[model samples]
Target: MKICVLNGSPKGNESVTMQYVRFLERANPGHTFTTENIGQRIAAIEAKEEEFKKVIAAIESADAILFATPVYFLLVPAQFKRFIELLFSHNAGSAFFGKYAASITTSIHFFDHTANEYLHAVAEDLGMRWTGSFMAKMDDLLIEMHQEELVRFGQDFLTTAQQHPAIRRTYLPITSTRPDYKSAGIPMPLDCGDKQVLILTDAAPGSNLEKMTMRLASSFGKAASLVPIDDAKMNGGCLGCCRCAFDNTCVYTDGFSEFWKETVLPADIIIFAGTVKDRYLSAEFKQVFDRSFFMGHIPAFAGKQVGFLIEGPVAQCATLQEILRAYPSLQGANLAGVVSDEDGIAMAVDELIDSLAARCLRLSKSGYVAPGGFPAVAGHKIFRDDIWAEMRAFFRADHAYYTKHGLYDFPQSDLRQRLSTTFLSLLLSIPSVRESAQKEMKKHMIEPFEKVFSESPVLKRQKKEG
Candidate 1:
């Protein structure tokens, strides 16, 4: 069986993700694997029609298509994303029809699920038989057990592809019509006050996206600033070169870094506007994010109130909605609101946009950023640990920032908690103490937090205690 591997890493064959591809290739001798450096050569592929056709020809001839990529900003690299866009735009999707598809990605296990979910959906949308996925932590191949598991996974994929097994779609087709939205003029206009409100969009002219973004900007009044990233003369998608890792300095001499610090980073409230292309936001929007990787794992939008003005089936795309929400959440920012023009009623969409703008302004004024949810919480820990260890050598700036900001709040450093835990463990080892502790464990669990329910005001208590 011939397998066409779509390599989505910006570093091409040299990427760590492709090493996994090499593992599979070496493990499976009978099956031939042909690799295309999609992310590396995306520019040429998009510019030259013949290059794209060559790639399509490979896909058409292959029995299976393997999507191997690194999770960049919770999805595939912007370049790989553009390849998907090109595939759909140039009517080359038919090449993938009826082919078996599977994906393998290498990341720090940071939001890998979302990335794989995106790939799985894309393959399904391309009329491919979505088979299985293998997620390898950056160094999983080094472990003996993991190495064995990887071989097993590789064999299973070929077996599955050859068997012609029935496949079921995981995602339903999105059916939404963009409403003709008109600003109803906010009943109670919000005063952005001293907040630096920034509305960023990749809205196409005469499109519903433009209308939605315009409505949002109008709701925020003159104090707000709207910038169309689509018009920005961006050099290109991020090249996975780790030059930025050393000190947050990108190799590109373009105005992108200046755009980040001067425009995006200074905003107190940022409203992202876009039209969903396919399963997610436009590749241009994704490029903004991927390029922003120059900032490393820092919280660029910390304490900001972030909102979204989308002109797509946001309600239907649960994963996209989650990705949008998680982005703000992970950045130490509050998800003020997400307004999509999913409803056919123009009035309904207008009201939603107005409400979102009002909420964003109100949150910004109060300086009230909601507590980070699971995405942020888990992501913080992931970044913290990696910055202190694996990423420290590459991202020295992150290491310095984490140390200075106390982001490396490792549990091992909590001497008091460690002592208490050790003492409790010893006590619990005794039969009598263990029995007593087990009986009261449930009651003790809530004892510390019970004051919040009974106390006059926990907020005041916290401040007073401090």
Candidate 2:
């Protein structure tokens, strides 16, 4: 059987993800494997019709399709994403119809599941029989146990593909009707003062997204500045070289870093407006995200407020919404809310604009941030562990920042808590003590809060005022 390997890594053959593919191919010498560097040659593929035709032809001829990519910014690289966009744009979905599909990704186990979920959705959307996914850590190939796991994955995928099993469709096709959004006169004036507001968009001219961006900017009065991603001069997508890890400097001297630092970083509030394509924002929007990796694992937009103005069927795409929510939260920013075009033209647009303005102002003034959810908590812990262990020397900047910000809040580091827990466990080993502790556990947990309220200066002051 002929297998088409869609290599979605900017590093192409040199990518660590591709190394797994190479291993699979070497292990399964009976099957023929044809590799395409879709991510690396995306520009040429887009420019040359024949180059794209060759890729489609490969897919059309293949019995199975393997998507091998490194998880970038919680998804595939921008270039690979652009290729997926091309598949829809060129009406080439038929090439992948009924083909057996599987995905393999290499990451440090940080949101790798999201990437796999995205690929599964994409493959199913393309009318492929989704086999399964194999997620490997960056160093998994080096371990004997992990190598055996990879071998097992390869055997399973091949056996599944050959058997031609029916796979259930997980994601239903999303039908979107573009709403005709028109400006509802001038927005009500708001005193934005010296606050820096950024309206970042990938909206093309005459699109509803563009109109929404314009309306959002207008709602901010004179404070908001529009920064269309298409206008930004980005040389290319992130190389995933880890060169930026050392000092937070990208290999490419593209003006993106300067623009990001100068225009985006200092913003008090940021409005991201984009049209959803495939399962996510446009590839150009993703390019902006991928390129921003130069900032490394640090929270660049900490304390800022962010809102999303989506011009598509956002409610239907739960994964996209989760990604949107996670992005802001991971950056330590407050997600004001997501406004979608599905809410109708006049009412939704006007209400969202007003709400965004009010929310941004309120959050900025109050400095109230929603506590981190699972993504933020899990992502931070993963980064903290990785940085402190293997990446500490290479990512000195992250280490320094983590040290300075007290991000290394490892539970084991608290000696007092450790000693207290040890003592409590020993005491609880006694049957009598265990019975007493079990009865009083709930009360013990509430004691600290009770003490706070009983001996509180703030409550006393409020009582005196009352």
Candidate 3:
């Protein structure tokens, strides 16, 4: 079997993740392996088109792919991510479909499970079946598994790869429109006169994304507005408290409330412009991202054209899902389109205002919803196998993955039962005569309850695994 390993560390060949690759090669000597240091090659490739062609050829021919990376700030390194961005600029669907892709990530403080899940989700979005995750923590234990785990990974990866058919078959779900005949449906015209557009931005004032933002704005009828993100005193950052759902206003009245009332409410199309900081939205953008909820149930941007302007590599669709989940205020808006890598800060702003205007015009005329539907999860339902896989990963006792996003919340209905059990258990226990025994029991009864109150979302496990 021939394979390609796309290593995603900016450290290049010297990364610890490469050590794992060496182990895998030793474990399975029969399989041919070619490694591409994506981080090291990304910068040099700009002047060398042939290098990308070779990389693309290798990817196309490979029976399986090993995406190995060291977790940087809980995501792929910026440079490595850029290489992936470039892949899309080429033929995105052509190279990746039907390939057996697995992820391997090395991290120090945290296990690589979340990072692997992100990659797996990306593969799923690209219509690729996820084989599985081969994740490890790079601590002292790494030395021990360097031999055995590598062999196990090599065998397992290949075994899974063979199960897939060699002939790639693309499945298109049955559509209302016939396959052979072009739908001669009446074409609709766009109307842009009375439409309004709203622009919301991190106000990086001079960034590449601003250009895309302006283009998006102009499409929406020249509707553009800028909301600066760097003000630290505003809203003290979203506390993840869902209070805004009912209150209809931010609890901390920094500048978010003012921005929403004075600027955000009046626009017909809203353009979200934010720079990428550490592989995620900037801190200022994050604060505004969180505070945007102040729009509440009032239908501020409902039926309005909305688009996102991003400054980094192409964002994973799953990350967008997470964002929607975190903020429900965006439910009714029409998602127009996205623009990335704006070229410069000034360009980003110009693009931001222009894009808002354009999006508003387009929204007024075409009235098209974004390719996918609202609350992205609703558009793409969770599969039975995915739920099962999550349960399986959970049962593996990979606590780091569970800690990051899964276990923090409990279902609301079950909370009463849990609280009852805790109260009853504590009340039923009698005090022991020994002081040490009494102290221990009291601590046990009180500590768990305190922890429960402090953490609103209780840890919840799936009732049934797939």
What TM-score do all the candidates reach, one by one? 0.95, 0.97, 0.44
Give the CA lDDT, 0 to 100, for residue 108 in model 2: 92
Q: Which ten residues in a row have the lowest lDDT in candidate 1?
A: 181-190
What pairs collide in candidate 1? none
Q: What is candidate 3's lDDT per residue for 1-466, written digit by digit as tens? A: 8889988765667777888887788768898888988766766654478988878788888888889887653456555655665665564557777788888787542324446766675555455666776677654235764556666777878888878844332222211211111112222323456655555666444445554444544444333444445433462444323355444555676766776666766666566776554334554554454466454322245455666666654443445334533232334466566655533344444544455455557664666544444333331122122223443342332223234434323344388888987786676574543445566876766776776555555343222332
lDDT of 1 by residue, 393-434 (tens): 889988888888889999999999999999989988999998
Backbone clashes in each candidate structure, one number apiece?
A: 0, 0, 54
Best TM-score among the predictions, by candidate number: 2
| Alpha-carbon lDDT, every model | 0.88, 0.90, 0.56
Worst 10 residues of 3 by lDDT: 174-183
lDDT of 3: 0.56
Candidate 3 Cα outliers beyond 4 Å, as residue runs: 109-111, 145-147, 165-272, 275-316, 320-466
